[model samples]
Target: MSLVRISHYLALCGVASRRQASRLIDSGRVTINQQLATHTERVDSLQNLDICVDGVAVLAPQDKQYWLYHKPIGIDCRLLISDPSSLIHLLPQTPRLYPAGRLDKDSRGLLLLTNDGELTQALMHPDFYHTKTYVVQVDKPLTPAFLTQMAQGVTYQGAQTRPCCIRSLSGFDEGDTFEIVLTQGLNRQIRRMCQALGYKVIDLLRTKLMDVELGCLPENTMRPVSAAELLSLTQLSELTSLS
Candidate 1:
């Protein structure tokens, strides 16, 4: 392993993101070989150095795991131990894992969970423009103008969202459902955009993320991401890094 910054090393060990790891080091909670870690310290795990966070030892996981989960609605995405609504309790037992992206509490969808920090960082970065697809049902009948406005781009809270691909999904008697694909993940983006257009979202569900599809995965269930999918993700990450 090449030398990496202390924060990056900690993130690779699944402690937290690089920024959070820096905060831990700054607060004197991180130590390398029993000495307080420094922001400028670079570490290589091959040196057999002792890395501890809050006196608990952390090691780079030898078997990095990736999983796709159907995140049911009303579950917080955080891994908070104290919050009963957090999805951490529902996940399978494994090395500490983190979400590559997030789905808001009120929305249910496909979520990617993995212990690979570098991959998570790459996938979540705005510059990557990874696509996430969602199916939404609103409180009123659908209109051509509404679809056009959403597809064109909506300005909400002073920022115009990127233009997205959206089309109505027929079959529901209510006839107000639409499928939308967005390359940007904003906070409650769909709900906010709908609200800005004087519409209330009735229900929202994510069906796909990047190259992975929700498919027939039952709600509240999870499965290991396939080897082929993992290869694709790693290749995409590498390509983005090079770009």
Candidate 2:
């Protein structure tokens, strides 16, 4: 590859956006050829520059990159500048990248982080209908009729939600909680779904996206995605074709 700005190189490295990489450059975290990079510096990968995150630099790759972040309640899914007190600020290597999709402030769970712009766009496009699963708690008891309406779909803000798969894990006289999966993401979808059914939302949490599940992951923790997950998401993307 020809030499280019470090920010541009970072964007192509699949670690983050050009805008974000600039932040790293300003923070003095990104290095070029084993040297700490000053803002506006440029280099070429074939020239053998070592890009580091934190203090440990990485060997940048052309392969697509992915990361899994367990967002805690109150954490905004949108990327932010490093604040010593912020949740994602603890990232060993900070980069500029945005969330694949949004999660409401009150809700929390798995969220995907990626640097591939085309892949991010394809996965979030409305026509692709990427499936998202969430666990929702309601103030009212689960009724057979309620489940049916949600399954059949309901209108929110004048637009109707696509029919979704709803499973009632339990329903007591006091309240009901269910797991619902939907392909479309409308703002406050789970909450809106309950309100449409004449129910009030108590809590909502996303536990899975496509094949990636939160499992026993603790909140605020993050790690590099496994090779298997990378393969699965790629395969799923191919199957859906994002067409």
Model 2 misses residue 195 by how many Å? 1.3
TM-score of 2: 0.70
Pairs in clash, predicted candidate 1: none
TM-score of each: 0.90, 0.70
Across residues 71-91, which tens digit of lDDT does each residue of candidate 1 receive?
988899987779999988886
Q: Best TM-score goes to which candidate?
A: 1
Task: Count clashing residue pairs per candidate.
Answer: 0, 3
* Whole-model lDDT values for every prediction: 0.86, 0.74
Q: On residues 147-234, what C-alpha lDDT tens digit does candidate 2 reach at each position?
A: 9999999987898989999989886455488999999988888888789779998888889888888888788877777888777777
Q: Which window of ten consecutive residues has the lowest lDDT sum in model 2? A: 83-92
* Model 1: CA > 4 A from native: 17-38, 171-174
